[model samples]
Target: MAAVSLVSVSTVKPLGDRVFIKVNAAEEKTAGGLYLPDNAQEKPQVGEVVAVGDGKYKDDGNRVAMDVKVGDKVLYSKYAGTDIKLGTDEYILLSEKDILAVVS
Candidate 1:
């Protein structure tokens, strides 16, 4: 799921097959122009990849390639990542498996 993070983009580097994502905020206003309260908002499922790990190592010592890269917008599974707050911003750290698709 997407989360809002203001953390410095250069501060953290993901490890293994993990990726750091800067989540997009849920809509505050509906298409009809009705404003929704915070509690009524649904969590967003899309985010921008801030950082990615060097691919995970295989048993044979070969590195698996990462499909997504920095700045790629992607779709991820809801509730699949670890929630983290660095400074005032929030970020998600998730395995590549948690990412379902890359947004074009």
Candidate 2:
């Protein structure tokens, strides 16, 4: 029998000034607070940091500090960013400047 290969891991490695984010889809609620169908729910405009890129470069040749780290909740603009597929998961690789705000 031929050998079978199984893989399981994260291949996303963000470069400098970039971040790999996994947007969280919004939840649905019915009139009585019940769960609504997936198609009825709207797309999510919020997300959490799955991975953060390295620090950016400053004018003085020093690496600027990264404000956000892994597992940070954030809010982003709707209809922004491009989608990519890594392995079996979907992610968005966008510049830090495009990030709207960091949720506390």
Candidate 3:
């Protein structure tokens, strides 16, 4: 399968319960529909689901269920993830908890 590289980091085999996401670029327009100039536009906290790791841990030694899978568009908290670099590209690896919701 073809995969996009983020942060120039080679394919990261995430540990259990972790996920990889590639942030989507922010829109230039404001919430009020006012289009902000490039200099005034703020960054967006969005990303595309890239890869998923194994399920979460269970007290019984079983894996807990996972809600999101690859290719899911999700909203995350600002500064909620850890950043890594890959060949000049950037990507984030965050716990599933950090993901607020999966965008419809």
Best by TM-score: 1
Tens digits of per-residue lDDT for model 1, 1-104: 23436546697889999999978878999999999999999878899999999989999999999999999999999988887766556678899999999999
lDDT of 3 by residue, 5-49 (tens): 533434576778888887776687777898888778555678888
Q: Model 2: which ten-residue window has the lowest total lDDT?
A: 1-10
Give the candidate order by descending TM-score: 1, 3, 2
Off by over 4 Å in 1: 1-7
| Best candidate (score: lDDT) | 1
Better of 2 and 3 by TM-score: 3
Reference-based TM-score of each model: 0.86, 0.69, 0.73
- Model 3 vs. true fold: TM: 0.73
After superposition, candidate 3 runs with Cα above 4 Å error: 1-10, 28-41
Q: Candidate 2's error at 85, in angstroms?
A: 3.3
Pairwise lDDT winner, candidates 1 and 3? 1
Instruction: Provide the clash count, candidate 1.
Output: 1
Per-candidate Cα RMSD to the true structure, in Å, reads 3.3, 6.1, 5.1
